[model samples]
Target: MSRQELPGLPTEATMLRDFPWVVVRMRCHFCRRGGDARLAVLAAKHGPYVTMGRLVVEFMKECAWAPWNPTRRPQKYGMKCGGYCMDLRRPDPPDLPPGMQGLQLIEGGLSEKLPAAPAEFERRKRVGSDD
Candidate 1:
């Protein structure tokens, strides 16, 4: 299914219990921080149902690069912490068939059509008339 077909943020759908690996690996390239935690221990501490995204947030609270950290220093250009779960990164969109080409409509679609004005317009015109 496409990303849009999913019911919630992709991360929310993945819980701590979804990982099959005994060790859950997390890394942040910006800060050069990496670690591996026992899956069972993580689940026990954060609860099995906590999302990988939420867990990452809790783990990166002390990182200077974390955008959500209130005490983080301001930078020339704001950069979010590149923290990620090794097991749960989103997969690339599937390639189209060899003979098929992708197409996107930029304009002139039904979504651009506006509804007709209500009868109230006639009443307002009568009220404003000089005659």
Candidate 2:
């Protein structure tokens, strides 16, 4: 399904600490490999701030069908891993009020513009040494 259809699904920026479940249950249909990971243990190993998307990638690394698995046989038309989290299929939560939706408010708000890069540094092409 397209990402737009899965509006309730967590985005790449969704941190591990923000996940709804205490334990993450992941299964790979291709390898028949599955496991339950405690949120606390995962947070300790990967940090609470690590994104769910990143964890998904890490979790699928060992699967033979995983596209990014370097040790897997090089096949031009191999099936991709069907690894996924079980908790992700939970019913979507009720929508928040309009005012409560969107980006979280920062303490000081964001800067109007980014700081300009140094022109001298941009022009330099030397591999080493200040000169």
Using TM-score as the measure, the top candidate is 2
lDDT for each residue of candidate 2 in 4-85, tens digit (9 for 90 to 100): 3464565555788877667777889888899888889999999999987788788888777888777777688878898877
lDDT of 1: 0.71
Evaluated at residue 53, the lDDT of candidate 1 is 81
Report clashes for each candidate as comma-separated counts: 0, 0
Candidate 2's C-alpha runs over 4 A off are 1-12, 92-131
TM-score of each: 0.54, 0.57
Evaluate model 1: give its TM-score: 0.54
Residue-level lDDT tens digits of model 1 in 98-117: 44655655778788778688
Q: Which pairs in model 2 have colliding backbones?
A: none
Query: What is candidate 1's CA lDDT for residue 123?
Result: 42
Stretches off by above 4 angstroms in model 1 are: 1-12, 89-131
TM-score of model number 2: 0.57
